[model samples]
Target chain A: MKTYKCYCIDLDGTVYRGKEPINETVQFVHHLQQQGKEPFFVTNNASQTPDQVLSKLSGFGIEAKRSHIMTSAMAAAKYIAYHYPGKDVSMIGERGLHDALLENGVNIVSSSKEVFVMGIDREITYEKLAQACLDIRQGATFISTNSDRAFPNERGLMPGNGAFTALIQNSTGIEPIFIGKPQGHMLEMIRLEHQYEKEDMVMIGDNYDTDIMAGINFGIDTIHVNTGVTSTEEALLKSVRPTGTFETLVECI
Target chain B: MKTYKCYCIDLDGTVYRGKEPINETVQFVHHLQQQGKEPFFVTNNASQTPDQVLSKLSGFGIEAKRSHIMTSAMAAAKYIAYHYPGKDVSMIGERGLHDALLENGVNIVSSSKEVFVMGIDREITYEKLAQACLDIRQGATFISTNSDRAFPNERGLMPGNGAFTALIQNSTGIEPIFIGKPQGHMLEMIRLEHQYEKEDMVMIGDNYDTDIMAGINFGIDTIHVNTGVTSTEEALLKSVRPTGTFETLVECI
Candidate 1:
């Protein structure tokens, strides 16, 4: 097995599955940490701030660095700051996205015809969506954190950020530039921030579509674990297979 | 112009646009009422009640009967009452849908696996959408009022019922049974209630996709008034053309 300098790990499915940590993944992450390597926690969950994510990880007995946590919100903020600098941005998101934008020095406005970013806003309203449509129609650059259609909760799989993004897209007939997994923006952000080559990075996750495709899209090696959304059998069936497919991260350890 | 006993007029584009009524449409409605024909005002707007719509019409100097007004909410209520009688139905809508379901004697429950109906809910919440997805995933029959992607408002083309429906559909991977224009449910309801044959009915509207398509789908005559969404030139390009296309309802008068 080959080792990478930067291991980009997905949070929800890879490290833990909604409050319960996968034992093998936890062990593998521990092994990496013991080797003086800090893996980046790359999550598409734009709802939570880095500190919140760190708290969740700490609950699972995994100590992660705040700077090593690259959320979709952070990536979107950085993407906007890098691409459209000095442009006023309008957003529809939660605390994570709002904080990330402020941290990245992106000017937040009530409404803008410059740029618009969206994430998982639990308190979503018709007025927010309406304003987004109006802005997009007025030639605002539309950007979304992720394209996850539905995500699992304690109750069931609920509508995620992508569904709301779909609403705005359907209403305005405009597609948004997604800055999450399967699009490679987050992975690219990690690479650029840490000054690591593509070969030095490897994405490890249990989801085939978001995690594996994200790595592949970013031209990095990907390892798919079968302890979550996609099984080994399903991952093998894809035309462009992952670099490695295992029953669990224990195999890598 | 071919005279019809039942003239099924669309509300938004045909009768009025936003707060203002089209003068020709007002005159046309007055003409029909003077001739002792109470034309049915068929609308995909599931937000307002029949009385509310009637009051708006009356404000434009056109007296319309309460029974002669058919909203998507009413049609959805009647559809549920007829097909799935006594079924506990769950909904995501406003006063119109709420009253319509209760008036039709359809049992309304907080959450149900029997039936789920959705309308244009401006006060849409993430929890409401989550509950709807959960109910639909639990094998509930999903139904939406209309499929109009965007509706005009004071601001601009805001996210309509169809956009929200698309959100639920995307999340649950379930197609909803649309009970609005372009599906013929409202027209079918009007036909069944008034005991008028399809031949005796004519759908008059400014939007070709919703109004004309509904009439054609219901196997009734359709008149296209170029005063709203679809222009007369664009209506002429469709493979299935309306029976008549005019600049305004004054041409028909």
Candidate 2:
């Protein structure tokens, strides 16, 4: 376990099913901690807050701190704060984004007749959309929390932040500054969190399009989990496949 | 206008900006009406029902009958019905999908875990996701409304049905039968709707990934509008460029 300085695990399939964590996950995580290896819980699901995720993991007895987790939503908010701070933002987002911005002390307004911060808001409205258009036409900057359009749920799939991003972009004729997964910022943030540079990092996740692709795009090592849509065969067949494949952490560990 | 038999106009930049219709869009639509050309409003936006779309369009004084409008949401439900008829479904969608499936006379249940049709639901919940996963594990067939991931909107961009499609795909290791733009079905539907064969019809819209590519994929002439994010320059530089490019409909007309 010491051989791996940093181990990142995906939710949904790799870690647990719903509220129930994987059988081997707890033992493996305990082993890693005892071996002094740092573990990171990372996901492309931008809908949930880190606290929410941490709480979910806590249900499985894996005590994770907010600092121990990195989400696309958080990463996106960090990107915006770094590049365009102190701007009046018109937000279409969930608690994750609203909390992130408030943490950074960014000003948010209801109207996009100002700059718009795009986030995953499950309760989207047409009036909000109208305000976003108004902002874009009024020459507001467009910022996206992340570019991931969808997230897998037990019900099938749900529209992630990118869905709202796409709609506003089409109507307003403005492109957004994407800040999350499948982008470079999250990689940097993860690297900083794990105290590993790009070369030493390995991204473990279930989705190929987000996790593996993020590693590939950022020139980092990737490990794909078969627990998601990507089978062992599918991972091997990718144009830019991951460096390793695992059915679950039980096999990899 | 009589030189063309069908008038396929894109929603965002081609028709209106936000709720306000674009200049000359009203006249061109009226022009088509007067010239006795059949008008079809094609949108890759799978969020709203066709009637909702019509209602929105009507807000700006553009009269659109629900029958004259086509969306990916409609295409997705119909495609699923064709393959998995009379099966209980878990729907991850908004009113658009609900209306479409209802219109198609497909039976839907709340706890359907066998066959599912996923679309963009702004108010998506974990229960819906869990049900989808449970059904898939139980050998359920998954169908997506579209694969666009995101669509252009006045709110800067929003999660389109494609985003919803991706979630289920990521979880179940299943690929959806996409029904919207850029996919083959919508164009086939367009041909059928306009009573025009592939050779005689032309697809005009703003999106390159959807409208232009769908047209090209189906062997029809394409007219690309820079209504959405794609500028006229970007639209032409595409590997699969459109047959013609216009900044706006008025320019082409």
- Chain B TM for prediction 2: 0.89
Mark the 10 consecutive residues where model 1 chain A has the least summed lDDT: A163-172
Q: Give the residue spans of candidate 1 off by over 4 A.
A: none
User: Residue-wise lDDT of candidate 2 within B23-79, one digit each (tens)?
Assistant: 667766777777776578887676788878988887877786677788877887777
Model 1 C-alpha lDDT per residue in residues A1-253, reported as the tens digit of each score: 8999999999888899898999999999999999999999999999899999999999999999999999999999999999999999999999999999999999999999999999999999888998999999999999999999999979989899999998888888999999999889998888888999999999998889999999999999999999889999999999999999988899998
Q: In Å, what is the interface RMSD of model 2?
A: 7.0
lDDT of 2: 0.71
Local error of candidate 2 at residue A62 (angstroms): 0.4
Candidates in order, interface RMSD in Å: 0.8, 7.0
- Give the per-residue Cα lDDT of candidate 2 at B180: 70
